[model samples]
Structure formats: structure tokens, C-alpha cells
Target: MMFDDLDATVKALFDDAAAPAELRAADISFDTPDRAYKPAQATVNLFLHEVCENRALRDEARVMTRSGDRYTSRLPALRVDCAYLATAWSAQAGGLKAAEEHRLLGLALRWLSRFPVVDERFLRGSLRTPPQPYPLSTTVAQTQEGRSNAEFWSALGVPPRPAFSVTVTMTVDPFDEADELAAARRLHLDSTVMPHAALAGRVLDHTLAPVQGAEVTVVETGARTASAMGGEFAVPGLAFGDYTLRVQPPGGPAEQLAVTYAADHQRLTVVLSQP
Candidate 1:
């Protein structure tokens, strides 16, 4: 799981020998710090308390990648914030336990606070080779706004302990590859511009077969064209107004219908009666 990788990454941050020997020797854990859980060794518990979308880093743009002859457009990766509650635990009793825990917690805070952005070397597992192209962002010892510490501890059935929040922002790409589009090899420019709107449609017979070579005309403008193969026809340079459309099938009777032509009135389907 991604969280498991994140846990490993966090643990890696404390694995350096340069840190205090006590801190390096302390065990790193990603477990629920509940009342029932008791550790026999000095442990730094990292409980993932919240997972949410980092709206502040939301990206609406799409990412485009071009292959040899095709290109794909995919939505940008989502930025997610994983917040962890970091606390220290020691097996010692009374004041010794509290002091050791505090010392470990302080050392952890010092180590974590140094990296606002996780170093690439410290990233572990899938995080080390993230699919998305965003760096892991970190926030240390910051006050998180969501669930209060008291409520969080209460939910875990444990008393509140001294702890700091560690938030790491990671990227998730959940969508499959977008449809690929073939590359355009050539461009055609049409210089003959129509001063007015155009109308287009297809001609079909009663049985829904294409009626090629049928004459179609706009009665008001006298614009006319013959339906080509596949029953497609177009009449350009027509004013925006009401007009009567007349369609005459080859060796067949003519049909007339009224239509209102506007810029958006682009298509019409003319179906002829069966012989």
C-alpha cells in the first residue's frame, strides 16, 4: 500500500547514524497508539490520523505526452495530504519513561524539521519511484485544523499524549491512460469564405438508405446542391431567416419543408418517401 511505503520513508528519515544514537536506536512504528498497546522498547509511533485531498495544490490542467505517432492527454495527478501523529514511547517507569519519551520525541522533531521537502535518497519503495512527477512535500510540527488532538485520542481509547503532527503531500495518478490521437501530418486551408451562414444535411429514403444525387435547394436564397455519396449535402452563403427547403429525388416527386436558419441551425435530415 502507499501508506506502507510512506511509513518506510518516514522510518528512513530516522535511520541515519548521524542522528543521536538514542534516536537511531529507537524503534520506528506505524501502529495505532491505543491504551491496549504497550511496547517493551523505546519506540517512535507514527499513527496516520488523516488522509485528505490537498486542495491548495490542486491542478486543473491536463498533462500531454507524445509518443511516436500518437499523443495522450491525461488529467493532472492529485495531491493528497497524509497526516501522522508522531509520539514517543519508552518501557521505563514513571519519570524515567517520561524523560526518555520526551528526549526521543525532541530528537525526532529536530530530525524531521530539517527537511521541508523529503530528499530523494530517503524515499522508499514505490515512493522512491513515484509514478507521478511531483516531489514529496513535508510539514513538521504544524497545527492541523481537522480533528482535535483530544478527539483523536478519545477515538483511540487512550489519553492524550504529547505529540507533533507530520504531514506529507504525495501525488496519486488514479486514471488509466487517456485515448490516443493520431498525429496530424498535413493541414488544408480553405480560402473561399462564406459571407453568410451555411446549412448541411443528409438525404435518406423511406427505408433509411442514402439517397445520393438528390437535388436540395433553399427556396428563398435559391442555393442548391446535389447530395453526394452517403447522402451528404451542404448549401453555404444563406442569410439567417425562415426559408422553405425543397428536396427532389432523381426520377421522383419533390418535397418541401419550412425551416428557420440561424448560425446554430447547421444540420437537417431529409427522408424521402418510398416509391
Candidate 2:
């Protein structure tokens, strides 16, 4: 599902008229074997250079690729130089998108193509470590599991934390107009609720406030997932699944629900009753 979203986004971006056209343009010179392979190698080199030149990469390279002639500081410089050369070659011959997609696909084929390699071993080992920590004031998630840990540690080239899924069960009543009204007012119920949030992609034992199984489907997402620690079951790293959310009590009739999401951090409420 994650890869699906990425693939869609990349395809959409490439389809746009303004995005680098050369990236999407077909290679007519494929008849020449040397010309055919040159593009792929050029792109791979470009991606490698970008990764190497990044400040974080420079630090890691210092530890990974150490030599008397090539000091740690030179790592970033070398990578940038190499990438620039490749980028120039691609731009002069292939155009922008070709150069861009070449790098994009070189580094992230899953996003371009929907087939991602799904191995527990690779997932566990895909943690990325940043060259430096976020600002002291920034909130860093403590759990090193699933995709977040994979993304975080992969940046640093560290192994991903183990993967775990958490389920949050809640119940609401469609008959209780008063409680529904109260919850709607207090929780600011909206369209942003995931169709069924409990079966989302990540762990969220942190942010959710408990409710006995009821009639309405409960949904939540965004920063709340990470911030829902301490008082509630805040879920993290949801993998995309429909949840059998408990609505209000068994005696009540189900009401129509329409969830809408306007922004990245919109909050939602679950109201079982209608006006």
C-alpha cells in the first residue's frame, strides 16, 4: 500500500507537463548496446553521489570508507563531484526528468514500480540513522520498529527495529444523541477519520482514549499517532487495512457517516448519532 501510494505519486508527477520531460522520454538509441547501458550506469552513479555527498553520508563514509589519501571531509566532496559529473552528462544528453528519474528509479524502484521486495529480513535491516539528531525540542519517536524505524535508521544505515502491530478497540452508541453531540463537540469529529482506523498500518497504543465497543467506527491519524503516548493507545506505522470498528451499543440504529480530510494534521471525532 505504501509503495502503491508512492508509485501513484511518482507517475502523477511524471505525467505532468512541467516535470522534466526527458525523464519520461523514450530512449530511441537503445539499438546501441553501449548507449543503452550508459544511461543506467549514469543514473546509478548520480544517485550514489547524492547519497555520498549528503552531510549525513559524509559522516558515515568517514567511518565506512577511510583511507590516508581520502580523509573523511573529502568524502562529501568526492561524492558531490561524482554526482555532478553524472548529472551534467545526463542533462546534456538525456534532459532533466531522464536525469531525475534515472536517479529516482535508481534509488527507489519500488516507488516507480509497484513491486517492492517484502522480506522480513530486509525490513529488519532497513533502519536509517541520521548524521545528527533532530533539534532537542523536536519530538523523536522512541520506538524503533516498522517503517518509521526503517526510515530513520536507513538514513543512518542502521538496522531497523523489530516490527509489531497494535490493535485499538473502541465502542460507541448511535442511539445516544446527547453523548454523540457531546463527543462531536469535544472531539471535533470530521471527515478525516480513516475508513476503519483500528486496522491502520502502524502501532498506535499511545494516543487513543479508550471507549467500550459501541456502534460508530473510530478513526484517527497524523501527529496524533506518534503523540498519543502516555494517556492513550497512540498507533504508529499503520499498514492499511479495514477495521471492524464497534459503533454504538447493539440497540441503536447506525447513522450515516461522512469523513473528510482537509489538511495533513486534521483531527477527527467518532459520533454514532445524527442530528
The candidate maximizing lDDT is: 1
Per-residue accuracy of model 1 over 180-259 as CA lDDT, tens digit each: 78888899873233345578778999999999999999888788999999998888877678889999999999999888
Identify the leading candidate in terms of TM-score: 1
Model 2 reaches what TM-score against the true structure?
Answer: 0.16
Residue runs of model 1 more than 4 Å from their true location after superposition? 187-275
Q: Could you tell me the lDDT of residue 150 within candidate 1?
A: 85
Give one digit per residue, the lDDT tens place, for model 2 in 2-71: 2222223223433445434444453212111222234532231111111122232233332223344343
Q: Which stretches of candidate 2 lie over 4 Å from their true place?
A: 26-275
How well does candidate 1 score on lDDT at residue 80? 98
| Per-residue lDDT value at 8 in model 2 | 33
Candidate 2 lowest-lDDT run of ten: 132-141
